[model samples]
Target: MQTITVEPLAQEHIQILRLTSTPHLSGGLDTIAPYSVWITYRLNTGANQHTWTAAVSGYRVLRNGVTDMDAASIVLTNLADQDTTPDWLTDLIAKYTPSW
Candidate 1:
Protein backbone atom coordinates (compact mmCIF):
# COMPACT_ATOMS: atom_id res chain seq x y z
CA MET A 1 0.00 0.00 0.00
CA GLN A 2 1.28 3.41 -0.96
CA THR A 3 0.23 6.79 0.42
CA ILE A 4 1.27 10.37 1.04
CA THR A 5 0.85 12.81 3.90
CA VAL A 6 0.66 16.63 3.84
CA GLU A 7 0.32 19.68 6.02
CA PRO A 8 -0.18 23.42 5.60
CA LEU A 9 2.56 25.97 6.26
CA ALA A 10 0.22 28.22 8.19
CA GLN A 11 -2.39 27.64 10.88
CA GLU A 12 -5.25 29.43 9.11
CA HIS A 13 -4.77 27.55 5.86
CA ILE A 14 -6.01 24.09 4.83
CA GLN A 15 -4.22 20.96 3.64
CA ILE A 16 -5.43 18.64 0.90
CA LEU A 17 -4.69 15.20 -0.59
CA ARG A 18 -5.42 14.11 -4.11
CA LEU A 19 -4.38 11.20 -6.33
CA THR A 20 -5.14 10.09 -9.86
CA SER A 21 -8.34 8.12 -10.20
CA THR A 22 -7.93 6.92 -13.78
CA PRO A 23 -5.50 6.20 -16.60
CA HIS A 24 -5.31 8.65 -19.53
CA LEU A 25 -3.50 9.39 -22.76
CA SER A 26 0.13 10.37 -23.02
CA GLY A 27 -0.07 12.39 -26.22
CA GLY A 28 -2.04 11.70 -29.35
CA LEU A 29 -4.11 13.72 -31.86
CA ASP A 30 -7.28 12.96 -29.90
CA THR A 31 -5.47 13.75 -26.67
CA ILE A 32 -4.27 17.06 -28.09
CA ALA A 33 -7.69 17.97 -29.46
CA PRO A 34 -9.18 17.42 -26.01
CA TYR A 35 -7.25 16.48 -22.87
CA SER A 36 -7.94 12.90 -21.71
CA VAL A 37 -7.09 12.67 -17.98
CA TRP A 38 -9.38 12.91 -14.98
CA ILE A 39 -8.56 14.73 -11.77
CA THR A 40 -10.54 14.96 -8.53
CA TYR A 41 -9.64 17.77 -6.18
CA ARG A 42 -10.27 16.99 -2.50
CA LEU A 43 -10.21 20.27 -0.67
CA ASN A 44 -9.70 20.66 3.07
CA THR A 45 -10.56 24.16 4.14
CA GLY A 46 -9.49 24.03 7.81
CA ALA A 47 -12.59 22.52 9.40
CA ASN A 48 -14.15 21.50 6.11
CA GLN A 49 -13.13 19.01 3.42
CA HIS A 50 -14.65 17.23 0.48
CA THR A 51 -13.80 14.68 -2.23
CA TRP A 52 -14.71 14.74 -5.92
CA THR A 53 -17.18 11.89 -6.34
CA ALA A 54 -17.56 12.29 -10.08
CA ALA A 55 -14.33 12.65 -12.02
CA VAL A 56 -13.77 16.05 -13.57
CA SER A 57 -11.67 15.12 -16.60
CA GLY A 58 -9.22 16.99 -18.87
CA TYR A 59 -5.85 16.98 -17.05
CA ARG A 60 -2.91 14.64 -17.74
CA VAL A 61 -1.66 11.96 -15.32
CA LEU A 62 1.98 11.04 -14.64
CA ARG A 63 2.06 7.24 -14.66
CA ASN A 64 5.73 6.69 -13.88
CA GLY A 65 5.22 7.46 -10.17
CA VAL A 66 8.11 9.06 -8.23
CA THR A 67 10.67 8.78 -11.04
CA ASP A 68 8.31 10.99 -13.01
CA MET A 69 8.11 13.65 -10.34
CA ASP A 70 9.68 16.10 -12.72
CA ALA A 71 7.09 15.39 -15.38
CA ALA A 72 4.31 15.46 -12.81
CA SER A 73 5.57 18.81 -11.66
CA ILE A 74 5.25 20.05 -15.22
CA VAL A 75 1.71 18.73 -15.50
CA LEU A 76 0.81 20.87 -12.51
CA THR A 77 2.92 23.85 -13.40
CA ASN A 78 0.21 26.19 -12.19
CA LEU A 79 0.24 24.65 -8.71
CA ALA A 80 3.87 23.60 -8.62
CA ASP A 81 4.65 26.42 -6.22
CA GLN A 82 2.51 24.64 -3.62
CA ASP A 83 4.51 21.43 -3.80
CA THR A 84 6.14 20.20 -0.58
CA THR A 85 9.48 19.01 -1.88
CA PRO A 86 12.94 18.09 -0.47
CA ASP A 87 12.40 19.31 3.08
CA TRP A 88 8.68 19.45 3.82
CA LEU A 89 7.91 16.35 1.79
CA THR A 90 10.76 14.57 3.54
CA ASP A 91 9.32 15.40 6.92
CA LEU A 92 5.92 14.11 5.86
CA ILE A 93 7.46 10.87 4.67
CA ALA A 94 9.46 10.42 7.85
CA LYS A 95 6.39 10.83 10.02
CA TYR A 96 4.76 7.96 8.15
CA THR A 97 7.76 5.64 7.94
CA PRO A 98 10.17 6.59 10.70
CA SER A 99 12.27 3.43 10.33
CA TRP A 100 12.88 4.02 6.64
Candidate 2:
Protein backbone atom coordinates (compact mmCIF):
# COMPACT_ATOMS: atom_id res chain seq x y z
CA MET A 1 0.00 0.00 0.00
CA GLN A 2 1.01 3.66 -0.46
CA THR A 3 0.64 6.70 1.73
CA ILE A 4 -1.24 9.90 0.78
CA THR A 5 -2.04 13.24 2.45
CA VAL A 6 -5.01 15.66 2.28
CA GLU A 7 -4.77 19.17 3.71
CA PRO A 8 -7.44 21.86 4.02
CA LEU A 9 -6.30 25.42 3.46
CA ALA A 10 -7.53 27.77 6.18
CA GLN A 11 -7.71 31.57 6.70
CA GLU A 12 -4.34 32.25 5.08
CA HIS A 13 -4.51 28.89 3.34
CA ILE A 14 -7.51 29.57 1.04
CA GLN A 15 -9.17 26.17 0.33
CA ILE A 16 -8.50 22.55 1.18
CA LEU A 17 -5.25 21.41 -0.43
CA ARG A 18 -3.90 17.88 -0.88
CA LEU A 19 -0.45 16.54 -1.84
CA THR A 20 0.14 12.87 -2.29
CA SER A 21 2.12 10.22 -4.18
CA THR A 22 5.81 10.37 -4.68
CA PRO A 23 7.40 11.64 -7.90
CA HIS A 24 9.95 8.83 -7.75
CA LEU A 25 7.98 5.75 -8.70
CA SER A 26 9.24 2.35 -9.88
CA GLY A 27 10.00 3.97 -13.26
CA GLY A 28 12.04 7.06 -13.83
CA LEU A 29 10.12 10.05 -15.19
CA ASP A 30 6.78 8.31 -15.55
CA THR A 31 3.66 10.29 -16.54
CA ILE A 32 2.97 10.80 -12.79
CA ALA A 33 0.53 9.02 -10.45
CA PRO A 34 -3.01 10.04 -11.52
CA TYR A 35 -2.13 9.45 -15.15
CA SER A 36 -2.01 5.75 -14.35
CA VAL A 37 -5.09 6.26 -12.19
CA TRP A 38 -6.83 7.39 -15.44
CA ILE A 39 -8.02 10.95 -14.79
CA THR A 40 -7.22 13.56 -17.41
CA TYR A 41 -7.98 17.29 -17.49
CA ARG A 42 -6.61 20.62 -18.74
CA LEU A 43 -5.85 24.14 -17.54
CA ASN A 44 -3.88 27.24 -18.58
CA THR A 45 -2.51 30.09 -16.48
CA GLY A 46 0.23 32.67 -16.00
CA ALA A 47 3.72 31.47 -15.07
CA ASN A 48 3.24 32.58 -11.48
CA GLN A 49 -0.05 30.70 -11.00
CA HIS A 50 0.87 27.58 -12.96
CA THR A 51 1.75 24.91 -10.34
CA TRP A 52 -0.96 25.29 -7.65
CA THR A 53 -3.74 26.32 -10.02
CA ALA A 54 -3.14 23.24 -12.12
CA ALA A 55 -3.40 21.21 -8.91
CA VAL A 56 -6.83 22.60 -8.08
CA SER A 57 -8.33 22.07 -11.53
CA GLY A 58 -7.41 18.55 -12.62
CA TYR A 59 -7.25 17.37 -9.01
CA ARG A 60 -7.86 13.58 -8.72
CA VAL A 61 -10.63 14.06 -6.15
CA LEU A 62 -10.70 10.76 -4.28
CA ARG A 63 -13.98 9.04 -3.47
CA ASN A 64 -13.53 9.33 0.28
CA GLY A 65 -12.45 12.29 2.44
CA VAL A 66 -11.79 10.45 5.71
CA THR A 67 -8.12 9.74 5.00
CA ASP A 68 -5.24 12.15 4.49
CA MET A 69 -3.81 10.26 1.52
CA ASP A 70 -7.11 10.51 -0.31
CA ALA A 71 -7.23 14.28 -0.02
CA ALA A 72 -3.54 14.74 -0.83
CA SER A 73 -3.80 12.91 -4.14
CA ILE A 74 -6.73 15.02 -5.30
CA VAL A 75 -4.93 18.23 -4.40
CA LEU A 76 -1.55 17.15 -5.83
CA THR A 77 -2.99 15.99 -9.13
CA ASN A 78 -4.81 19.28 -9.46
CA LEU A 79 -1.74 21.25 -8.41
CA ALA A 80 0.37 19.37 -10.93
CA ASP A 81 -1.66 21.09 -13.67
CA GLN A 82 -2.49 24.38 -11.98
CA ASP A 83 -1.02 27.91 -11.88
CA THR A 84 -1.32 28.48 -8.13
CA THR A 85 0.47 26.42 -5.46
CA PRO A 86 -0.12 28.10 -2.11
CA ASP A 87 1.96 27.89 1.07
CA TRP A 88 -0.75 26.10 3.05
CA LEU A 89 -0.68 23.34 0.48
CA THR A 90 3.07 23.14 0.77
CA ASP A 91 2.80 23.05 4.53
CA LEU A 92 0.56 20.01 4.27
CA ILE A 93 3.03 18.38 1.92
CA ALA A 94 5.86 19.08 4.33
CA LYS A 95 3.89 17.60 7.18
CA TYR A 96 3.43 14.38 5.28
CA THR A 97 6.73 14.30 3.44
CA PRO A 98 9.13 11.48 4.38
CA SER A 99 11.61 13.96 5.75
CA TRP A 100 8.95 15.63 7.86
RMSD of each: 16.2, 17.5
> Across residues 1-100, which tens digit of lDDT does each residue of candidate 1 receive?
9898977532221223343432332232212111222323344445353322212224433344322212212122114423422243333333433111
- Candidate with maximal lDDT: 2
Per-model CA lDDT versus the true structure: 0.29, 0.31
* Candidate with maximal TM-score: 2
lDDT by residue for model 2 over 1-100, one digit each (tens)? 9998965432112233333553312111222233222222222332222222223322233334222223222334444423343454444433433210
Candidate 1 global lDDT: 0.29
Candidate 1 stretches with Cα past 4 Å from truth are: 1-31, 45-74, 81-100
